[model samples]
Target: MTTAIDSLLQILDLETLEHNLFRGRSPQVGWQRVFGGQVIGQALVAASRTVVEDRQVHSLHGYFMRPGDPSVPIIYEVDRIRDGGSFTTRRVVAVQHGQAIFSMSASFKVPEEGFDHQIGMPEVPMPEDLPSEKEMAARMPDTVPENIRKYWERERPIELRPVDLTHYFSSKALPPKQYVWVRASSALPDDPRIHQCVLAYASDMTLLDTSMFPHGKSVFLPEIQAASLDHAMWFHRPFRADEWLLYAEDSPSAYGALGMNRGLLYNRDGVLVASTAQEGLIRRKKPRE
Candidate 1:
């Protein structure tokens, strides 16, 4: 595995503090707050550890209660809610500084035959047809904003290639829809739970940003405040995180200083593997007197 993927695996590997409790740490990336996806993935890992290997996660719902302190370790406490014949439920709370920073409930089920149906994947350029993250950074024009250039040039565990680049440089209001091809920077182990956790980490990457597309705003803007409030995901089929997947995202509404966005993740062969929904705080900052 590449260093990036290894680092990600390390981040997901939680230490057992006690019965039903796990401790996780963040990478020292100089961020003021921990990444929401990291919390979600780690919380899921904690919940999964308590579940039987025959049961796999099918759905998860999480809420970000407070900004996580990246400088310190997070403690996750899991509750074994229920264990039925075919379904298991777990609730996890991630605590930092003596308070809950995030909470999540995950449900798992044993594999069973079921009717299958999914919406067709949208037609878009494949990952190979788009500019690589490194190439995109290298081709950035001088007029491009520094903050955006920094984001493009940063090395991350997941590589994203947007189908369109207009929104990156322009503030023009556009449709609240976007498509990005994403995948882990390196191969991962053959564990399905690991793949699911990694995908959960990547799910939060760009979903909330789609909410700002119609307003021609971004979380990076100094005058705009954006943070995820709640996140939900449903795993539909098995998939590998190291393979390219299309993240088709759109915002359905933005009102009352909040935005709601949803996404469908499809593999290269057009099979829908997962779906996500999120609501985020998106308030514009007032000018100082």
Candidate 2:
């Protein structure tokens, strides 16, 4: 298996050092701190392990308590909050340096017959027409600003093809909604759980940035600061993370140093597998001359 695929699988193997205590390592070559996606992904895996096969994860809500240390392995403690007939709930606390760096609550639902209807997928160019974010980053010379380059370098495992690259950094105003094609660079394991959690991990990246386009601000620009405060996702259908998925995101509001963004995940077949919403810290700093 390729290294990216291997990382997806290795992430599932939570080290069982003690009862109710699971250890997780970092996927290095990224930020100074642990990637938010890694903690979110690993926490979902930890929660899923404690639930029965019949009950599958349907929704998850998480909060970033503190910055995670990439140098230290995270210890997850799963609390079996409730196990009933129709629904089961699990709480996972990710700790590093003896402090809770992240916490998540996942609810699993037993399969049942239900009526369903969803909005159709938006029409967009195929992933083939867009250049991968990696390719774009490679074109940047060493002269590129460290803050801007680090934003691109820290990204791996998943591939991103923005619909409008210039809009991401341009000083001009743009639309509130943005579309990007995303998928795992390498194929994931056959296990359905791994694919779902990996999708959850990758979902956190760039979706919130869609909101900033309208304001002509980006983390790449010196005047803005961005961070995810909380994230929530709901699984709607089954899909593969290795295959292309259209991530259509939009931000309806940005005020009080925060931005609200929502996105829908659509597979190449146009199946809507998931929906996500997040509110993030969108603080503005003084622009440098």
Candidate 3:
């Protein structure tokens, strides 16, 4: 694995503090608050550790209660709600500074053969045909904003190749839709749970940004205030994070200073492996007095 992926795996590996409790920390990446996806993925890891091996996570719902303190360690407390013959439920709360910052509920189920069907993946150019992150950065060194350029240049665990790059540097109002090819930067362990957690981490990367496409704004913009409020995901099938997957996302509505977006994850073979929905705060900043 690459150093970035190794660091990501290490962060996901929570420390066992006691029964039903684990400790997780954030990378000192110069962010004011912890990334919502990191909390979600770590909380899932905490919940999965309490579940049986046969029971795999099928769905999860989470809410951001408060901004997480990135400089401190988060304490995850898992509650084993119920364990049935086919399904298991676990609740997790992430705490920092002795207060709850995020909470999540996850459902796990045993594998059972059933009728399978999924929406066909949209026709788009393959990741191989798209410009790599470094290439894009080098091509438009002056056009890309400083913050966005820094993000793209960073050695992230997941690599993203967007089908359309116009939204990054342009402010033209367009349809609220986006497609990006995503995959782990390096090979990961064969554990399905790890892949799921990694997918959960990557899912939060750009879903909320789709809502801003119609307004020609982005979370990276300093004048726009954005933060994820709630997030939900459903794992429909097993998939490898190291393999490329298409994240098809669109925003259905944006009102009351909030934007609602949904996404579907399809593997290379056009199999829909997961679905995600999220609502976030997307209010514009007021002029200074």
Name the regions of candidate 2 deviating beyond 4 angstroms: 137-155, 286-289
TM-score of 1: 0.98
User: How high is the lDDT of residue 2 in model 3?
Assistant: 42
- Write out the backbone clash pairs for model 2: none
Per-model TM-score versus the true fold: 0.98, 0.91, 0.98
Q: List RMSD in Å for every model shown.
A: 1.0, 2.6, 1.0
Q: Give lDDT tens digits, candidate 3, residues 116-207.
A: 88899999999999988888899899999978888888889999999999889989998999999999999999999999999999999999
**Candidate 3 C-alpha error for residue 6, in Å:** 0.6
Work out how many backbone clashes candidate 2 has.
0
- Cα lDDT for residue 65, model 3? 91
Q: Across residues 96-186, which tens digit of lDDT does each residue of candidate 1 receive?
A: 9999999999999999998989999999999999998678778985756788888888889998999998788889998999999999999
